[model samples]
Target chain A: AQSVAQPEDQVNVAEGNPLTVKCTYSVSGNPYLFWYVQYPNRGLQFLLKYITGDNLVKGSYGFEAEFNKSQTSFHLKKPSALVSDSALYFCAVRDRYYGNNRLAFGKGNQVVVIP
Target chain B: DAGITQSPRYKITETGRQVTLMCHQTWSHSYMFWYRQDLGHGLRLIYYSAAADITDKGEVPDGYVVSRSKTENFPLTLESATRSQTSVYFCASSESSVETQYFGPGTRLLVL
Candidate 1:
């Protein structure tokens, strides 16, 4: 079985400061990881994904994530945070070698960007 | 307009009522998925369809039924609504099993 863990319940960061959200995973084989953001009363929007190439992958709205094979972690990052970036973020993972196509999602981290 | 859509956006029903949530996409994606989101659990897949008429169960599927008669539409039905079944339901579609999935606006259901 594949699973993802986002240890933090809430992440607070000041505007213009670097922000990070941690995620760790347990899967049978290589993993396909993804990050999504949800605004109030809105559906989740895809942020970024890490499939097979470089460890650092850039995504929408100036967000990026680093995939560390040694750490078994994929953490989302932003160089500078904005107040508008405050929202609920989720990390999901799927086994690459497994054909089930089911993704295991973390409980989610609520980001609060303070101005 | 041109993306995935779910209806009705908000619904209120009583226990034991049967309700159906509709999803439609225009991308012609081959895979469709239904997920329920709650406070602690981010999102739990109820069912997924690889193509028209091809469906499978996911993490949580006991209380829901899904059907895809056409490529653009997938509807989830709750045979007997329960208070525990109240959640925000989201419909998503991807070009294939490995592709990025696009989600709909979601339907908020309340069962009293």
Candidate 2:
């Protein structure tokens, strides 16, 4: 079964410092990876996605993710972190071969940006 | 003005009572989905509708019922609500399978 794993339960970083949230996925065929961020009491907001080409994908709010095929990883990164960036991050995977179209999500990682 | 919306932003119900969470999307996307967010579980899909009158089960579908009589509405009903059913439910829609999904504000349900 296709699944995503977020190893870190929490990540604390200083404001203006680079931030990295790790994510790894397992799928039967090509992996369709996505990154989402959620604020308190709010629904998830899409950050980025990796479908086919270009390992590095950019998304909203100065977020970017790199898709690694060999390692089956799609890690979210940002050049500089902000206090507002502190939120819950989720990594999701979708199987490209089958038509089920259900997304498998990771447990999620809470990011804290210390000002 | 054009986005997804969910009804009853917050709800509380007794166990074994039937509760329905409403979801509406103005984008008229071809795909609609229901998911529950828990503390340990990021998000587990409950049901999804490809189009009007076309519905399918997702990862976790038991104890829930859904109907897509119209293209814009996808409501999820818990036949018999349980204490474990307390969760934050989200409704999302996408133009197609590979398209980016847009989510609503979400409805928080608490089963006592």
DockQ of each: 0.81, 0.82
Which 10-residue window of candidate 1 chain B scores lowest in summed lDDT? B1-10
> Model 2: how large is the Cα RMSD against the reference?
1.0
Q: Candidate 1 residues B1-112, lDDT tens each?
A: 3499999999999999999999999999999999999999889999999999999999999989999999999999999999999999999999988888889999999999
Question: C-alpha displacement of B16 in model 2, angstroms?
Answer: 1.3
**Residue A101 displacement in candidate 1 (angstroms):** 1.0
In model 1, residue pairs whose N, Cα or C atoms come closer than 3 Å (at least 3 residues apart or on different chains), thus clashing, are none
Q: In the order shown, what is each candidate's alpha-carbon RMSD?
A: 0.9, 1.0
lDDT of 1 at B8: 98
Interface RMSD (Cα, Å) for model 1: 0.7
- Per-model chain B TM-scores are 0.98, 0.97
Candidate 2: residue A86 Cα off by (Å): 0.4
